[model samples]
Target: MREGAVRWLSPAGFFTMRWWEWGPEDGAPVVCVHGLTRSGRDFDALARHLAGAGRRVICPDLPGRGASDWLPDPMLYQPAVYIAALSHLLARLDGPVDWVGTSLGGICGMGIAAMAGHPIRRMVLNDVGAFVPKKAMARIRDYLGTEPVFRDIPALEAHLRAVHAPFGALSDAEWRHLAETSARPAEGGIALHYDPAIAAPIRAAEAQALDMQGLWEKVRIPVLLIRGAESDLLLPETAAAMAAEPHVTLAEVAGAGHAPALMDAAQIALVAEFLAQ
Candidate 1:
């Protein structure tokens, strides 16, 4: 894989969007987008598998997370801003792209794919839908505003496991990789890579309801919806409603809640198969 950055100007100032590129440059493009508070590295396993199968995979670290530059104003961290950044990234690509997005990333993909002349040829929404439960939204908002300090990598890893237990059963190596990539050296020991202020917009918009039915209906390309069986965020009823659409297909990952970390062979195979179709 190769790492690179794309510079662009936002209302706050100029910033660089970092990304990890894999597979042949001339091959078909597949863009993998991470959830809120996560980075591009989350897709390492999936990207490699797709790359090996002859696809150009691009995983981007959204602004305020991972290697991307933090915004000057926290309010600028909303979905519109993210969509704009994605637009900039896609403009540089050769042709249409197959998209894989998780949680917040999936929301952004819906907006883009609904556009009149979007370049998204296919889409995979990991564990999100138009209507997110109020309880789950509240749970996410409660923790997003705080920045915790850890004594070491091990300590940080423990915290991640506790908060993200819903990600299901990840191996020791997968947990370690997640911890290493999600953190950075801090004054005390280590801290999460993302900007805590990015939570401001989420908190502010908590009261507002999300209605993406119109957008979903507008999408002309094929879509795959992968849901964690025990997820509190994407309810089974919602998934059923989404699947009612002729263009959408649904898959569930057992032993997972809220979201599934696509690290296991089975999980990766599901994505690979969908994208291949």
Candidate 2:
């Protein structure tokens, strides 16, 4: 549950970003990144598993989420800015590190891991691949559109359950944990932790194509890809396309939708075993 903040520079300006750490600080580094609008706390349950095994696991709250500073310019929420900030964080770490990224985080991992001599040693992409079509973006937008302020935690939890049904079968306690961790005290009540403006760019990119073939091809390290069996974002064709490539292994998570919550033992083990290798 320990946390640290780093001052990173983006084109827009300097911002303070936060990261949570677990396990022995000197152990091999493992960075876990969450999806769009989600914070580093999303990895708490999984972090415990990796940490207990003696890995130095770090989960970063990308700017605008969790305890990090929100970008003044919402347009800067694009991947390039995020990559730049994360690059700064990696530079500070000063060594090779493994990466576990879900959705948007996976895309960021791809961008960095593809570099000539980036610090990333291995990567795990959850429910995302080299290509994300317009259709999937639209669905993501539908959920991202809701940013209501709730009178109580229970109501907020209920709202999250419906919108994030795609996270796949999180238990009652897990849902409550998510709600509590993902909220901020608003003027009237509690609201989702992330800045509402974070969704604007996503909405604006509904028609844009997200193709990372060049980056994916450049990533030479071993990669473990996890996709929800019922994922709409990562289509059967897209998963097949990535699995056929070099340095990539695909694992299907049954009973999940757009993404697997990774809270359950099975899902956590899927990630732990891959990084343990």
Candidate 3:
């Protein structure tokens, strides 16, 4: 594993934002963003593949997830704050970069890239688009409310399998790998790696009127939008509309839903080709 740097940025006055870098320090940089309720660790396989192709992959544990500290309020977990955090992250990089974002991460990338003078040179959005369907968002709420615990790693691993079966046909070893990285030892025993409060902002969205469709039209950067064939969040109509843009690139992965892990070679190759362009 290559060494990574930890940097803090101040967003919303009192919050200290944090992100980490991985892969070769001197190589071309690509920023990897994780989905909501997930962390930078989600990009491990993709990062390793990209690093092998001679690029520096920077993955951030979005606020309230992974090793990053939580904010005082969960409402701040929205994409706008994430866009600001990423803008700061890009500024620290000192140059334009390619981006690979999954779900919430992709939304943040889209939001920032839509603005003027954005630093993104290329983007790959995994399993998300400007329009997220009500059904998909509803399903998210079902799992997001749970605060489950387990007596041991095996039990936790079993739970992860049940909850994340949508991840497609990952091997037992693969499931074990994710389970190990995504669980933490707690006073009660083992639990998921993220803060429970992280779900608050996500659930609150049900009551708000989000205007994500308006935002997608403004993004001018070259984008590669990959959707899971079985995704409920990014409907086909929304994906088609998103791809209708002049600089958009789109792909659909089979046997996956909500998000594709970018775990396979074909997904990595598509992303690498875009970055190399």
Candidate 4:
């Protein structure tokens, strides 16, 4: 594991955002983003894989997750605040970057990369896209809106496995690692590392059926849409449509549901090839 400063950007003055870096300090940079309820650590395997190919990886703990400071108000956890934080990180990079985003992180990356003359040069959207199914969004709301506290690490691990069943089969070791990365000390024992209230904006967005067509159409960089074969979040039709874009490509991870872990050699190889292109 690598370490760095958990810098803060005041997107909301009351809270501070944190991000971690991996690979060489001066290596080719790749910015990675995690899913809803996940932190920067979610990209560990993918980052290591990319770093092995001589790429520096930066993974930010979006406002309310991982080591990042939690917001006093949940309303500010939306993409607007996230985009502001990412802009600060991009400024720090001082050059164009490649991006790998998973789920919610993918959506945020899509928005950033679509901006005019943005620094993003290439992107990989892992189990996410321009259109997410309404059923999946509703399912996510049901899970996120319910605040569940665990009594111990084992309990937390069990819960994480259950909640992330959509990720398909993973070993006990991987599950434990995920649990550890996703946990923080709570009053009695341990709870999720992410701020529970981060759910507010997600629920609100679902209620309004917020459309992101403008951003999707504006994407100028090479885009890779990675879908989980069984994913309810990113539909097959949407992936097909997205791949029709001149600069976009698509791949599917079999047996997964809402998302793919990208831990296997095949998935990593595909990503490496895409980045190399």
* lDDT per model vs. reference: 0.91, 0.89, 0.79, 0.82
Pitting candidate 3 against candidate 4, the one with the higher lDDT is: 4
Top lDDT hit? 1
- For residue 84, model 3's alpha carbon misses the true position, in angstroms, by 2.3
Off by over 4 Å in 2: none
Angstrom error at residue 82, model 4: 0.5
Q: Rank the candidates by TM-score, best first.
A: 1, 2, 4, 3
Estimate, for each residue in 157-239, the C-alpha lDDT of model 1 and write its tens digit. 99989988999999999999999999987898899999989999878875445667777777778999999999988999999
| Cα RMSD to the true fold for all candidates | 1.1, 1.2, 2.0, 1.7
lDDT score, candidate 1, position 226: 93
Worst 10 residues of 4 by lDDT: 3-12
Name the regions of candidate 1 deviating beyond 4 angstroms: 205-208
TM-score of each candidate? 0.97, 0.97, 0.92, 0.94
Any idea what lDDT model 2 has? 0.89
Report the poorest 10 consecutive residues by lDDT, candidate 2.
202-211
* Model 3, span 1-277: residue lDDT tens: 5434344454545444455566778888999999877778777888888888888988887777777767777777677777766776787888888999898898888888888988889999888888776667777776785878888888988987787776777778777877887887788898888888877877876633234887888888899989888887777888898898879888988998778878777777888888899
Model 3 clash count equals 0
lDDT tens string, model 2, 137-194?
A: 7777777757888999999999989878888988999999999999899989999999
